[model samples]
Target: MKTAGGDAAAKRRAGERAAEEVEDGTVVGLGTGSTAAYAIEAIGDAVADGLEIRAIPTSFQSRQLALEVGIPLTTLDAVDRVDLAIDGADQVVDDPDATAHGTLIKGGGAAHSREKLVDAAADRFVVVADPSKLTARLDRSVPLEVLPDARTVAADRARVLGGEPTLRAAERKDGPVVTDNGNLVLDCDFGAIESPADLARDLSAIPGVLEHGLFVGLADATYVGTDDGVEIRAY
Candidate 1:
């Protein structure tokens, strides 16, 4: 079994590898989560070494980290286009038979809505992950950002789609978890997703659901951190 420290190191390796892809004089999309944090730090270090780039953060967490690392911040509306986006996935489907290998499920940090917006707008989107995140299929719980008043309706809709929807609860606080957009989150479990694209569309069409955590064709590549080194899979 891999130790916690080993997993962390693996995440760092993948994140830094993706960070190295960023070039000077370009706009980057900074992602959320622990793995993406390493990429943000690497970019910050690059900035300290005179790399000039503007970054659009996917969440409050990412924004704060960028500030601490000295990566210049910009808004999506302020930039003409995003050159590249680096993000972490909660689970990645690494199917060998498929043409591409970066099908992913994200939103563990409740930032998938903004992350999707930034990632989809970028010219290239790279995913960073450790070996533990890799799987033959995406069977993880899908996170849904729903309107505060429509939580029940959204859950019912998810259940109608043959999913078990549960309101995500805050760890340090009481009651359900609220997103950065002042919305509620529903984590729906649909065992062994047969078709991610179709499920994504179905969940998206539901009323009151602002966004769902099913990233289909957004990833251009994935850097999987291993004990030996980082494995790059192009999508």
Candidate 2:
């Protein structure tokens, strides 16, 4: 654990280290969010230093950042596989017996749906975060992308699964926040998520659910920034 400033520094360190995995001529999956911004910046720097790699960005924000940083960009339509994906997690659980088992609660930036797509397409998914993001039990809210017409049904399903789902409101504009895919996001909080994998499956079964934030068994590794240093955990 660290102060707010220390946490930011740790995030930068984790991002920097994760970028080391990017090799020349590899197609990378770029993730969104503040922590992932660091990875994008590092990748951009690598490109300046002569690294030859193409990238698939998970969100508009990530895509814009990649362009600004000078990383060559591509689209999922143009590429079938990603060699690596570096992303951030709202919450990360390390224990195998735990409900999540490498599960994550993302979408703070409303990009989890796209992030999940890119992550799943990658051969390796690496999560980079400050130590504080790690937890024994996931207590953060799960973000679910739902079809506009099925918003009510999604909320109903969430309640049945023991969660309190709320439609996320946009801070800068009127009405609810809309995802890049033009869907609504339901931020569901099921206290202490005793079985994240089960909940994930249940969420996916819903007809209107496009994607949920629970990333069960997808992370190949994590780089956690700590007061001591960066800790590498490979699953």
Candidate 3:
């Protein structure tokens, strides 16, 4: 089942199938974003079906979803390792967009911050998405998370990398936009990222940087959900 850009019901079903794939007693990493929302529900449904997995969330939102799904949950600090990461992507460059799978432009929902951490701790990062997000290359619209004080510096650094960094803004219920991590978001247009791994490493080496939206070696495989089904990618 594909969930990209689909209604909530499709997302829910797709997420359910992903969660169903997890083996019992595995420490699973949960991701954020609308597509992830389905995975969360699936995990919960699996729990309802008597499958028990320790889920580590990528964000507060994921944490809440864990609880909502009734999936036994723990934090990364509480767990030693993750066996699998079942999450969603925003854009996939390889195929058409659908509810089941595709390339993804993730982290728009602000789960990128912890998503990287979860992926690092995991043995595998199974990216779930629809086809529309797949593309010829990665880093079309990259997201960066930086220290509140060093946002500009980070932006400048991205510009140096041939990226156009723009502060992510939103109309808050009261005032400012609130990121999922309760921080700010910046969108960087790097056009086509040829070397995603190297660029991600460079960003991490910089100071005052928290985390970027880029997922480098962290991903073991990407699963795209198309109108037909899931397509798997790996290096």
User: Among these predicted structures, which one has the highest lDDT?
Assistant: 1
My TM-score estimates for the predictions, one after another, are 0.96, 0.95, 0.84
Please report, as a residue range, the 10-residue window in candidate 2 with the lowest summed lDDT: 1-10
Residues 95-193, model 2: lDDT tens digits = 766545677888888899999989998999999998888888888899999999999999998999899999999999999999999999999999998
lDDT on C-alpha atoms for all candidate structures: 0.92, 0.89, 0.70
TM-score of 3: 0.84
Which pairs of residues clash in candidate 2, taking residues 3 or more apart in a chain or in different chains?
A: none
In order, what is each prediction's RMSD in angstroms? 2.2, 2.4, 4.4
RMSD in Å for model 1: 2.2
* TM-score (C-alpha) between model 1 and the true structure: 0.96
Clashes of each: 0, 0, 40
Clashes of 1: 0
What's the candidate order when arranged by decreasing TM-score?
1, 2, 3
lDDT of 3: 0.70
